[model samples]
Target chain A: AQSVSQHNHHVILSEAASLELGCNYSYGGTVNLFWYVQYPGQHLQLLLKYFSGDPLVKGIKGFEAEFIKSKFSFNLRKPSVQWSDTAEYFCAVKAGRNQGGKLIFGQGTELSVKP
Target chain B: EPEVTQTPSHQVTQMGQEVILRCVPISNHLYFYWYRQILGQKVEFLVSFYNNEISEKSEIFDDQFSVERPDGSNFTLKIRSTKLEDSAMYFCASSRLAGRNGELFFGEGSRLTVL
Candidate 1:
């Protein structure tokens, strides 16, 4: 079975600190990557996604993810973070680009930013 | 901005009883999906429906589970005989099937607790 692994379980950072959450999947074939955020008392929302072409993909709210085929990783990054950026982040992947493929998600990372 | 909406934000039910969770997808989305997240766990895909048929389903979606589009706007998931383990937050998502980047929009989940 295909699976995604998120390296960080919990992270605490001060405002304006850089952020990086690691995501690695165990799949050999082509895959589409996604990063989702669930803010406090809110539904999950797509932060960014990567399909093809550029390995570096930019997403909403100053979020970006780099899909590195060599490492089987799509890591989310943000250069500067705000207190409101605190949320639980999830990494997800579809095995192929086929329509309606089942999505596999990793255990999420809970981020806490201190003002 | 369009979004998916779910009914019954929180449900408390007895074990062995039946429960139906409702969702109202975006007006234009072609694909609809149902996912579940156990507290403090990863979100797992259950089923995907399109064109009034099931496009794909995960192993977690067993005979006890069923989905339906009863009308133009409502999609629902029904559990025949809810078990204690069935307690989880169920999320409904929809996305337009027209583009390569089919970013799914999810609703504020309906939390179910089987007592």
Candidate 2:
């Protein structure tokens, strides 16, 4: 079965700190990758997604992810973080093109950005 | 900006009782999905619906669980018999298309607590 793995369980950083959340998946075929964020008291929102083409995909709120097929990795990165960026980050994978919208999500990483 | 909506932000139910969670997907979305995250666990897919029927479901979605699009706007998940293990946050999501490249929009989750 396909599964996603996020390297961090909790990360704490001061404001303006550089951020990188590692994500890796176990799958042998074509895959779609996504990064979703959930702020306190807010719903989950899409931060970025990698479908095809350029390995680097940028998303909302200055976030980006790189899809490295060889390593089955799609890690999210941000150059400078704000206090508002404190949230739970999830990495997800869809194993094939025809699986409808079923997403296998990783154990979320809790990021706390101190102001 | 359109978004998915879920009702009863939190619900408390007794074990063995039936519970119904409701959701209203984005107006133009063609695919709907249900996912759940138990406290301290990764989010897991339950089911995906399209064209008025279930397109796919995960093993976690057993006989006790059922989904319905009772109307054009409302989609619901019914648990025939709630158990303590059923306590979790349930999220409803919708997308304009199927797996390939569709971006899923998620709703504020409904927290279910079974005693």
Candidate 3:
């Protein structure tokens, strides 16, 4: 079975501070990685995705993730976070296309960006 | 831009009662999915539907749970006998492409409270 693990359960950062959220997956096949963010009172939205290509993938709202296949990790990073960036982040993995595109998600990381 | 929509933003039902959650996926999406997140837990995939049938489902989706696309646009998740543990926020998602390639659009989940 494929599983995703997010190292951070809660992270507190001040405005303009650098941010990094660690994510790891245990899947033995070609996997698709994704980071989804849910703002308070809002739906989950895609932050970034990695299928295949350059290891580094950039996404909306100045978010980016690097997929390291060897380590089975896709960590999200932001150079500078804003107060508005306070939200819950989820890391998900889809084990190959044959698995019906089922995404196994990690326990979300609650990001609190203070102004 | 078109987006997914879910009904009864919140529903409170009693144990042993039947609960139905409705969703309207994007117009052009070919694949539909149902996921739920218990409070403080990871979002878990329940089932995936395509071609008017279930393509894949997780262990969480047992005989008590079912999904149907009754009409051209509405997709629904029905629970035969709800349990207290079934109280969670149910999310409906859709993607235009199947498998790992397509990006999923999620709806502002329907919160089900089984009391």
| Top candidate (DockQ) | 2
TM-score of 3: 0.98
TM-score of chain B of each: 0.97, 0.98, 0.98
User: Chain A alone, model 3, TM-score?
Assistant: 0.97
- The alpha-carbon interface RMSD of model 2 comes to 0.9
Residue A11, model 1, lDDT: 97
> DockQ for each of the predicted structures, in order?
0.61, 0.85, 0.82
Clashing pairs in 1: none
- Which wins on DockQ, candidate 1 or candidate 2? 2
Instruction: Write the residue-wise lDDT of candidate 1 on A2-79 in tens digits.
Output: 899999999999999999999999989888889999998789999998888999999999999999999999999999
- Ten-residue segment with the worst summed lDDT in candidate 3 chain B? B96-105
Instruction: Give one digit per residue, the lDDT tens place, for model 3 in B1-115.
Output: 8999999899999999999999999999999999999999999999999999999998999999999999999999999999999999999999998776878889999999999
Residue A46 of model 3 has an lDDT of 96
Which pairs clash inside model 3?
A: none
Chain A only: TM-score per candidate? 0.96, 0.97, 0.97
